[model samples]
Target: MRQKEIQLNSDELRSYIDSVGYEKDNLLEQLRKETQDLGDESIMQVGSSQGKLLEIICRIGNFNKCIELGVFTGYSSICIAKGINDEGRLFAIDISEKYTSIAKKYWEKSGLDHKITLILDEAINVLDTFIDDGLKGTFDFIFIDADKSNYIEYYKKSFDLIRSGGIIAIDNTIWKGKVFDNDDQTQSTKTIRDLNMLISNDPMVSQCIITMYDGMTLCLKK
Candidate 1:
C-alpha cells in the first residue's frame, strides 16, 4: 500500500519538527523575539523553518544573484545572505522604512550588511527598472512575499528577471487555506488561486506548492 502523507496536525508534532528539521540560529531566535514584540505585525515575519529552508535552497542551488520583494524584519534576508558566497548580493526591496529599519539592524548584527542592498520603493517600480535596464534573465533566484493583490504582477516581472533554470519562490500561496474556498472570492484569495491555476497549466515552468507555513510555491523556470 502507498504510504499516507504525514500531517503536522498537533502542537507536539510541530514542536518535534521544529526541534530537528533545522539547527536553530541564536541570532534568528533573537530576531524572532524582537519581531514578536511588535505584536500582530510580527506575523508578517517568516517562520524559522521556512527561513531555514530558504537558506538551504540558496546554498544548494549555489545561487549568487538574488532578489527579495519583501524584507519585513530581515530574518529571511539574513538567511538568504548567509547561504550565498562572500561576493554574492541580495537586492531586498520594501516600501516601508519603518519595518525595514528593523531589518537593517539585524543585517548588521549578522554581519551581512554588505551582501544585502535594501531598496526603499514600490516593488513594481524596482522590477520594471530592472527590466528597462536590460537585466532580463539575469537573476538566479527571486522571492516574492509582498502585497497579495500584486502577486501576479510580481510573478510576471520575476519570471522576466529570472534566468532559465532559476527559481522563483512565492510565499502565502495558500493564503491560510483560503485559496480552495470557492466562495471566498476576495481579491487576494482570487488572485492567489488564479496564479496557482496559471502556473499549474503553464508549460514554461515546473512548480510545486510546499504546504509549510502559509504555503510557498517554488517555480523553476524551464
Candidate 2:
C-alpha cells in the first residue's frame, strides 16, 4: 500500500511561527513547567502550537460538545478547552485520576474547570457508557491520543459517536517515523498504519494526514 505523508516545509514553519506568536499564554507556560516537575514521563505532551491549533479547530467546528480520548496530564485538553469553553462542553477520559487531578489543578487555575468534564477510567470502557448515556452523535469534534494497541477500535467508536461533518483528530499516526520501516513491526506502528489505510479508503470521510509532531490524522465524517 502506498501511504501519503504530510511534510512540514519552510513555508509551514514560517506560518506556524507567525500564527503561534499571536499570543502568550502565561498560564499554559506555568502549567508546562509544573508538569515538567512530575518527571518527564508525566509531562509527555503535544507542542504548544498543536494545542493552539486544537483551540482554533474548536472555534471553527463551532462545537460545544467535544471528546478527548487521552487526558495525559491534561495539557491538550486544557489547551482545547481554551477555545470552546465559553459555551461549550469538553469531556476528557483517562485511567489515571492521579495525573488527571494534576490536569484538574491547571484547569481550575485557568478558570476552565466548569466547562470541562473529566472521567477517570480507561477510555475504551467509558466510551460505550458515554454512548449509552446518549453521547452518540452528540459531539462535533474529537481528539484521540490514547493507547496505540486500541487505536483502530477508538477510531471506529469515535466515528460512531461523531455526527456527519464532525472532525476526528488523531495523534501519533506516523509513530515518530516508524511507519515507513517495514522491518520494524512494532505493534503500535502497525496498528496506526492499518487505521490510516482503513480511513484513507473509507468513503465516509474527507481527510488529510498531516505529518506534524509524530503525525496527526485529521478526518471529517461525510
Candidate 3:
C-alpha cells in the first residue's frame, strides 16, 4: 500500500521558515556556508530546521550531559550546546581531526569551547571506553549522525549510554526517503531502514520520526 506523500519543496519550506522568523546568527550562517564549500561532503551537515529542533529538544528536556557521535564542522554541536544547562558538557566524537579543527574554530567563536570536548577517534572505540569507564546511563541526550552502515550498532551502544527518560536522536533515518523504495538496497539505505524498524519495535524506548530535514528519529529511553 502506498501512502500519500505530500511535502513542501525546499524553496517553499525555506520561505515558510523565513516567514516564521527562523533566526540565524552570523556564526552559524558562516559555518553553514563553509561546510557547503566542501561540495558533496556538505550534505552531511544537518539542515537549519533540524538544528533548531535539536536545540528545542535539549531545552524542553533540560538535557545537560550530551554525546554526539558525529561532529561535522560543529553546526549541530553549537545548537545542542545552546539549549543545554549552563554547566552542561557535550562529548563530540569524530574520526576526522581536519573537519573537527574547523569545528573547533567556530565552537570557540561561539564561546562554547569550554562546554564541548572533541574526541578524535573512532566513535565505536570511544563508546567502548564509555562502557569500560562505567559511564553507562550517564548522558541526558545522545545524537547519532555518523557512518550510515553503523547506525544500528551506534544506536545499540547509545541506548546503553543514555539515562532513563533521556533522549537519543538519530539522523538520516529516512535516508532521503529511500527507505520506502524496496529497489534501493544500498548498504547505507538498508541499515537506516533496518535501524528505523528496530527502534519502532523496541519496547524499551518510545520513538517518532520527525520528517523535517531528511529525518531525525527521536527515541526516549524507558
Candidate 4:
C-alpha cells in the first residue's frame, strides 16, 4: 500500500485548515486583529493553528509549570495558559514593554492575567536567573520563539531548566524555508540550521519537527 502524504501548498488548503482545524475563540480573534494593526511586526505573532497546537500539547501533558521565552503580544502565552491546569503558572519573558503591554491587555481580557507572570528582561538573563534561583529541571514546558540568533543559547539554558520528560517547543525552525538554501549563511539561518542538526543527533532527547504554521520542533527531554 502506498502511504498518503498531504502537503499544504495552496492558499485554499491553508484557509481550510484555519477554518476547521480548531474551535475559534472570539478572544483570540480580537487579539489577532489588534496585533495585525502593528504592521510588519504582526507576523511575529503565532498562527491560530500553532496556538491551538500549543494548547493541545499542554493539555495532553497536563503541564503546570510553563515558560514562554518570547511573549510578543501574548498569543501563544494565552494558548499555553488556557491549556494548563487552573492552578498552573506561566512565566512569560520578553524585553519589549511596548509589545507585551498589548499582551497584558489581552491576557486580562481573556481572564488569564492571574495565570501568567510577565517578566520584562533579556531572555538569557531571565533564563540564567531561573537557574540561579534553583529552577533547574523543574519546568514542565517551555516554548521558545525569541531571537533566532540566540536560539542555541536559549535551548541550552531551557534544557537545564526543564525536568526529565518535559518538552521544549521551538518555533520557526524551518526559518521560512531559508534553511534549505545553502547560500543563505545569515546568522539567524545558520543558527537555526545548526540547532536542528544538534537536536537531531543529540541523545538527550527525542524530537520531531511538525510542519505546521512555519515549523515547530518539539523536543522531549530524556
Tell me which of candidates 2 and 3 scores higher on lDDT.
Answer: 3
Considering lDDT, which of the candidate structures 1 and 2 is the better prediction for this target? 1
Better of 2 and 4 by lDDT: 4
Candidate order by decreasing lDDT:
4, 1, 3, 2
Between prediction 2 and prediction 4, which has the larger TM-score? 4
Off by over 4 Å in 4: 1-9
Q: Candidate 3: where is the Cα deviation over 4 Å?
A: 1-5, 18-21
Q: What is the C-alpha RMSD of each candidate to the true structure, in Å?
A: 1.6, 4.3, 2.4, 1.6
* Residue-by-residue lDDT tens digits, candidate 2, 1-222: 998664553567747765754466888878777778888675367767778888988887787889899887788898788888488888899888877888999999889989899988888888888778887887888999988999999999999899998999999887877788888887888999899999999899999987666678899999
Candidate 1 per-residue lDDT, tens place, 148-208, comes to: 9999999999999999999999999989879999989999999999999988998999999
Query: What lDDT would candidate 2 get against the real structure?
Result: 0.84
The TM-score, computed over Cα atoms with residue i paired to residue i, of candidate 3 is 0.94
**Decreasing TM-score order of the candidates:** 4, 1, 3, 2
TM-score of each: 0.96, 0.88, 0.94, 0.96
lDDT of 3 by residue, 1-222 (tens): 999665744777667875674667789989999999889999899888789888999999999999999999999999999989989999999999889999999999999898899999999999999999999999999999988888988999999989999999999887788999999999999999898889999999999998877888999999
TM-score of 4: 0.96
The number of clashing residue pairs in each candidate reads 0, 0, 0, 0
Q: Choose 1 or 2, whichever is better by TM-score.
A: 1
